[model samples]
Target: MDSIQRKKLVNELISLIEKGNAHVSFKESVTGLPSELRTIIPENLPYSIWQLVEHIRIAQKDIVDFSSSAGSESLAWPDDYWVEPTDTVTDEDWNNSLQQIEKDQQRFQALLEDEQHDLFAPLPWGTGQSLLREAMLIADHNAYHTAEIVVARRLLKSWK
Candidate 1:
């Protein structure tokens, strides 16, 4: 597709993703997760709802930063490369963060709409696909983890 067409298509999909993620709230989304479910590690899963949110937040923030300042030093990988699942966070923090993510996603989309295809090109951070590719990945990531939260809630008998 031509550059203008690409921009329009990218913007359309980005709008859908931004809007789609807006409706998903950590609390209501986790309506199915019970206290017990949140704590279970049946097979010693490396991540919990807490950990997942932490990872996603870090990722989204990184993307926004990268989008705005392509010349800034990129985020470096952790030397330890170990993710801790016990991070403490309030449900409110998670929801607010997600809302911010929606905003960031929209901004990134707008920027993409205004720049050349190379603007959205992928970097080494992750999802070495185009910006549009990474945005969709973000949407998929949110859906995947939000679904996990729902599973935890239902397992806890917290769902109505």
Candidate 2:
């Protein structure tokens, strides 16, 4: 793609990451949830809303870190990605996790916006990995889990 086209596409990807598409945006899905209800696991869901938030926070950080490096090592599956099941989430943990998510998201955006890196170029340490693919993965992963949180909240009547 030409420079103009690349710029537009990058901006669009960032926008989709932020606002979502044809579904509830992450901001709308996650915000306004009662802190007290964050740890309540409704029927059928394996993870509480706080657990979901923490999972996203952990996974997103891993992805962002991976994207910036040439290393191909994956985080320990299901272990590093999730926290221990808990009945309560402290205000500090909850707030810190969300803030980390926001900060990492901005870093991802900056990675895309950086003129020095080529989004489509394959990383040397990987079989075939690129920033473009990683960005989409993070966005899709977050959106899916954010929706899960929304559903759990709805089931628990914590989100209206």
Cα deviation of 53 in candidate 1 (Å)? 1.7
lDDT of each: 0.59, 0.86
TM-score of each: 0.60, 0.94
Candidate 2 residue-wise lDDT, 1-160, digit = tens: 7789889989988987888886887778778888778888798889988888889999999888888776636889989899877878888888898899989999999999987878899866666888899889988998999899889988988777
**Per-residue C-alpha lDDT of model 1 across residues 1-160, encoded as one tens digit per residue:** 6777776777666755554545564435654444344434434344666555555666666666665564645666752222465535556765676677567766777666765446456665544656666667666766666666656555545556
* Model 1 misplaced regions, further than 4 Å: 2-4, 19-44, 76-83, 115-129
Model 1: which residue pairs collide? Answer: 32-153, 32-154, 33-152, 33-153, 33-154, 34-153, 34-156, 120-131
RMSD for each model, in Å, please? 5.0, 1.4
lDDT of 2 at 153: 83
The candidate 1 region of ten consecutive residues with least summed lDDT is: 79-88
